[model samples]
Target chain A: MSRKPVGNAPRREPIRTRWIWGVFAVLFVLLNPWYFPAGSSRLVGGVPLWAWVILAVCLALSVFLHFVCAVYWQTGDESDE
Target chain B: MNDSGVELAFAGASGITVLVAYGLLMLGVGVITWLANRGLHQSVDEYYLGGRGLGVMVLFFTFFATQYSGNTVVGYPPQAYRVGYAYLVSIPFFITIILAYLVFAPRLYTLGRRLSLVTPVDWIHHRFQSRALTTVAAILMLYALANYLLEQFVAIGQGVSGLTGGTIPYQVGVVFFIVIMVVYSWLGGMRSVAYTDTMQGIALLFGVIMLLVGSLMYFGTPGDAAAIMAANTPEKLAPPDGPGLLRWLSLLLLVGVGAAVYPHAVQRIFSARSEATLKRSFIRMAYMPFATAGVVFVVGIIGIAAFPGLDTAGSEQLVGRMASALANQSAIFYWAMVLLFGGVIAAIVSTADSVLLTFCSIVSHDLYGRFVNRDAAQSRQIMVGKLVGLVAVVVLVIIAWYPPATLYQIFVLKFELLIQVAPALMIGLYWTRMSRRATLAGMVIGAIFASALTLAGLRPLGLFNGLWGFLLNLAICVGGSLLLPPSMAEQNRARELTHV
Candidate 1:
């Protein structure tokens, strides 16, 4: 149920290939609850410890996307014209 | 699905006044835009895509306003209340939408500029050059967008009636907003839609944030809410177990991809004035889930302690109930809650207007222009699209007025059928060998399979029916593309068009 989505993509590498996508795959998996055992249900800062971890994962994804959009991603020129 | 039992003291006259003011503001934006760009309505490009000249902020807010509809504000908290900590998946899923966009948007944006792609199906017809594939893709988008519009109409009626304490009946409220939305949309087209979206998006964000603050002030702190959950339903506070985990992952996949490929969203991508403008807008969008979905999640969590004993059906009215509870606390909160509800209706119309515009563009550009009369003038094409959209609005308003019991199934089908187009649209963007036949086969079969699963209320293996259908569609289409031979001429033409 949790396999990485390695859809049958063509390997031509048109858009800049980056390690960030691999990083996204890892971050996405961590965002789910499988990695965290439910027995560790302690509270952290008044919220569930696991929930905080999930929020942190989401924040990391957001930060990664911010970085990706600003730096890693590049659409071709003449798109402005 | 009963009412939230919200009856504000000033819900009658003040609510209507705020609504009229908001409507007039939208019309003002339309009039100003129309006057500024008076002669641009002759072509679908100018009328529908805002002449391909939206700057960063307008593009960003329009994307925001269109993507996160009134439902996100009014309807999502009840869901969060029911799901508990597990609903935190909401934020991550929104981020994943940008992930979906990153896969296809960069290249699609480039090609859209070069080819003057007007609708999503415009891209399909260009890529595949198959009448069947293009027509089917157009039908799928039209179907999905129509269902989306119907939901907005229903929401507008409910929001208007709810906010005015039934001073405005649901039908009158629906008709009033529909006329307002159509007028502004017809007057200034996409420019008006984007400007009004900026206003609506700001209002919605402010209202949601205020609601969050009032909820925290009235209900209690996160600590207090946590203590209540620990004492009462401790399971809510824990990480999801096996099936729940599957469902979470499924949601991240389905909603993220489905929304990213939305027709209005695709149009927004094309409407960006420049590549840099689109990039900057997307960067902002990458962060919005935290404010909108994240805040709503916290509000829903606070509700656990605020109102404890309601069953599932009653909990559906949670946001309204909390606003009502907060309004009782203070004078300022009462007025703030009124704006929140008003903003909810505005956001609904904002979303509906965007959908209606895209629906019309597809009718005008893809279906009518391409098929009925290839030589027809652009003004005539736009006119036909507006007429058809008006007819659709009329019929859908009827359905909203006396919604059938099976309407929920139709609501669910929007995403189910819409996702079927993603394989064709996104994959065909890059893969040179992407076969039109395979794509058509995959899209049609996947739609049927997903519809059957949804109608039967089946989610085998804790996965969404759309996800299942999408996987099968992807496999067949991508697999078929891999196996089949591409026409070299077609391939070369695509490479020249895309330059990848």
Candidate 2:
């Protein structure tokens, strides 16, 4: 069994997605009531509009995570050394 | 007998029957795992980490169990009932755990696999070989985990007695399940916990979905809930004010990072069979909040329409009321509720067992093995951990029986202290310049600041006390590291240690 993870794996192009985490932080703030103050009074399909907006953003975020898990291939890469 | 008393009496009998069957099933899992891994008990790695061979499904469910405690089923709805739509923060906070994992888990998993790490403390010891640092980290984990275990004990007693209408007394319920948990854990260790957690996770998932359907059928939908709240409690339907928004954001950040760093959760990252298994598990976990917390949020929202005039304390009874009403509706719903409460008690036990196991590992492997007896046999270490875990559970059960009035105070205390470790764990992984002394200083200052602020009832600017301490913790770690740089060789070693 190989004890060294990055040592044995064949090298590939490093997937640079640190900036995507920044995007997630920004999106977190946007989904909150701070960004859509008017959503409190408004109703979307009998749910609060802010709640709907949060759900939409969460759906988008889940899709983004799915994409990241698929494509973020920096695991076991020793190129940093 | 009164009408409600008659109904509870009927439900009480059903609750006893279901709990007995559930207990048997869990014990069966214990026996099966023990039989499967009979000769391997002598090895700490096999006992504590399932030989690091969990596939994607088991890994995912074990992860699920750690993230969604009985609190998600029992505690969160009441919070939603109190805050209305604002409690939607629970969903995002759960998702943020996965986001926080994104920051560290990939690299950490790679490193842990290569090093054959067994506990979170082991990782810290590897990064900075200070005996003081390791012990402090272990003690902090034990404190938080003990608090966590106590909370589960209290919840287990209440859940059993409440669901059974005192058919099983609170003290009896706590002792009964704690005994079962200790035995199974003693027999099979992490394999038993992981197997039972998968069962409990599935049971809770089914129960939660049934709860949503049953609540909607008996009580009405969210639209009806919205209309009723508009008529009766319009303020609940309205948007949160500026202060409310700030508090929400603080909670989002606090629980996000806080829950992810939980000792058990972090250790699981080291237990995955392969990197692919770990990655797939996280992907599925990212979407679980919708089914788990999101469903419970809707249940709480529907409670506004179904049963009105509930203050926060009274709202805690909302799930019981809805489930009781469902039981009275038909035999099918009655059995369904019995299963739901059964699943709930199981969920509590599953969480408690995980906490207990992690607590033991830290004590035996980190404190005793490293500091007290460096040359102890691996089997001896496992035995010591089991005994210590049993004693701790007994002590915690006593506290649960005669719980302090400030039991709720302890519920918040663990997160505050646990999050203090985050600066060291998160920053140390990526930034090699992080000084060991600086990390220690940051933990000391942050823990003191958070605990003192909590004791004095001073949450400055309405932020959660943990957040306030975290900012200070982060500041110290950053500033202290820069001021007292490590020697050239030390810096090189630190960089080499962190490279993944």
Candidate 3:
């Protein structure tokens, strides 16, 4: 990840880059079920298999958010604190 | 709202008892917090932003309680019952809200902390130093917030009356809770609101968990419901088609961006004690959708097998009827369902209080403090804002009692205009040469265009009218910035405030 400050509030926004947003866009597309054929007749346990796929995508997005918040959200100042 | 004519079983004595207990608890917290933070009256910042001293847990729960409200519990299940698992998108939509925050929250937080922004409009005025732009954005947000509170008031009355089977009249329930809410907010301001939010969030989580457990025991598992859908209504189980995909994508964008840029949500960034406190709170919010929306999504799915062949209107009462059925099973569940109903009311009250506080803050800091009484002391400004908020609430309650036929249309237009403010807020965070004229033009035109489309009930390409307006707003903001660059001094200021 780039350590360069995107703007100067004393904090560098590494997530402001294009590739990170690209990754988010990809994950967002995967969240939709358009790729799955309509009525595939696939049911695992109780929900359709496609439904589980969507849930997994949701989980992935959340974990990614956690990673970003922990690693890249530092404000680089403590005077306010 | 209960077109299905569903009446809960434990609606009279038991429901009223829990409701009163919850109200008393919230009021007590407000008084205690007020006494502890006795210097709240010194300045607008101390009162409205809790002196920016919110820790991780209080901040986290306040964010949680504000985003998901009575509507989530009482309204979502009916949607799930109608559309089946397609409604699972609700889970991801909420998680995406965190993603939306990641886009702009870091920088916004730093700026707000450094500049001491009291409201979302404070950021706009400070950034552009333009009264025209700030007034437009504040008016739009204030209207949106007032309409939202009106909707919550209606929900409070319905939830109370539904839970009590009319033992407490609808108007009385709304007025009673509104009174309690005002007292606590008056005493402790944001601190009281966030403290009560912690209580309300816990009640909601526990109540929903019990509801889910009772549902699994009585109504059968989601898997069982899926099998029924597979046999009878396979369309409900299938993935989204072309048009469905469009709608799903639209909901994600609309909710992710619109909710993230909410004036209340933005002000929460200012309320964080430190970046670390804000970070921890956000990290927790990232996973909360699973525990809250996910559990409720399963309950809605379970409703499918339990009650079949209901019309669209009847399906809206799925949760109420399910709660009623569970209450009848035993004494334990009877109390649990009663508590669940109280939690529903608490959720609405929590939302209403936050909106009210923010509404009052904008009035005090932006309109009255900045314009009407520029030299007034902070306490005086705060008092005027409070009185105005109370008057607004009174006016809204009257509207609720005799809602106009066109009230729903007003709700849609207000929301559409609210989303139009997104372009200036998010893009202006990183863009150094963001022309204030470009932003002002974008905001004014975008709001008018969105409202016009909503009034005509037009969605040009199967997209939401709000989304269409947002896209146009962004185009104008970016394109106009390129066409008409910011003045050198404004550009220099932007670079200093934004990134290097």
Candidate 4:
């Protein structure tokens, strides 16, 4: 194990990192259900419109997380013992 | 009588058989893991964390089992039944937990591996070097874990009795599964827990799939149910009002933060074999909400139409009602319902065992080993922890036998307190200037505030008490840290500990 401090080591920051917070805000707005006061009359592929909105946004969030996990979430693996 | 009582009276012989088979399978896994790692048992790291060698699959399933639990299978449908489409918050809330991890897990995993940390308190002591802070953190974790274990115990008892009809009493079922769990965990520790977690996760996934298919085959899918609910109970299908939205947002933040900082989940991060493995597991975890929580949400919506006119109390028995109805339909469903019930029980046991094992590790390595005998052999430390764990479980079971007001309330209570620890854990990882004194104050104040509000039955506009606690926790942590800077030595130490 390297006892040297890797704390200040420079690594490439993912370009999408800056927008992650913005994405979270968007999800929060979309998922809050209160804004879309629609009833069962409006349907998307059989789901209530409100529910379909939440589901689609969540699915999109999951895909985004996958991309972030693969490309951006660095854990200093280069410094592992 | 209630639907649970009625279901218990008609529990089938096949369900009991399937339950026993599942129990045996868990035991067999434990024994195999124990034998494989016999030589490594003397070391705390080996027993508690599988020598930090968990691959993506093992880590993923263990994470899956720990996060989803039996509650997701049994409890969630009823919640969906009661709230309608609004309960779909469960799906995003679960995903948000993964997002919460993004804030700290990568850094912590790197630090944990570098330092060879075994428990959450280990990081506490290393970072702060404050006995007061570490002690408070340990006690809070223990209290939350014990509360969590109690819920699983009660659920196990109810699951067994209900699944078997009245053939097996609740007490007998709880004791039977508890004994098997303790024995295997004692033998194999985290390896056993993680391996059994994999099996339990698979069982739960299969069971939910079967239950959903059966529900669709007999009654209908979520779409069909939605159409019926739209006609009969439009409110169930409509968007939330103001207070409802408040509650939904509060629950989403509470679970996202609270579950992310769970001691067991943190330990899993430390236990990953490599950063690559941890990343892979989390990547998989990000999508699991669709397969796991999404399915149950649909099943619950199905229940709203399949069994309409169910009040809140009546809705709690939605899974039992639906499963029993399906079991009566045909032989295929009869067997599938049996497996489903068995899977539920196994899932509960899997979760309880992980909590119990983590509980033991904390007591063994953090409290007794740290304070009582710093020089005690690793084997001796683990033995003391095991003995303490046995006593703790006994007390918990006695309490479970006469459970407090409601199981759901106890579930909420633990989260209220556990989320208080999040500020300290998350901030301390990244902020070198966070004062230990401030962290301790945030925890103390946050816990007291949250508990007080919950006990007073005050929601403050339908929001959960935990969110109030977390807000205070974050505010206090930020304000206190800025106002009361870390001492020079403390700042140096923080940098050292958090260094990648």
Each prediction's number of clashing residue pairs: 0, 0, 7, 2
TM-score of each: 0.95, 0.95, 0.96, 0.94
Ranking by DockQ: 4, 3, 2, 1
Q: What is the clash count of model 2?
A: 0
Residue B455, model 1, lDDT: 90
Give TM-score values for chain A, per-prediction: 0.69, 0.63, 0.73, 0.64
Query: What's the i-RMS for candidate 4 in angstroms?
Result: 3.1
Q: Tens-digit lDDT track for model 2 on B86-139?
A: 888888888888878887787777778777888888888888788877888888
DockQ of each: 0.33, 0.37, 0.46, 0.50
Candidate 4 local lDDT, B225-268, one digit each (tens): 77787778778778777777888888788899999988999999
Backbone clashes in model 3, listed as residue pairs: A7-B499, A7-B500, A8-B498, A8-B499, A8-B500, A46-B223, B11-B164
DockQ of candidate 4 relative to the true structure: 0.50
Clashing pairs in 1: none
- Which predicted model would earn the best lDDT? 3
TM-score of 2: 0.95
Report the C-alpha displacement of residue A67, candidate 3, in angstroms. 0.7
Question: How would you encode candidate 1's per-residue C-alpha lDDT over B349-425 as one tens digit per residue?
Answer: 99999999999999999999999999989999999999999999999999999988865786657889999999878
Q: Write the per-residue lDDT of candidate 3 for residues B402-426, one digit (tens) a residue.
A: 8888756876565587888887788
Better DockQ candidate (2, 4) = 4
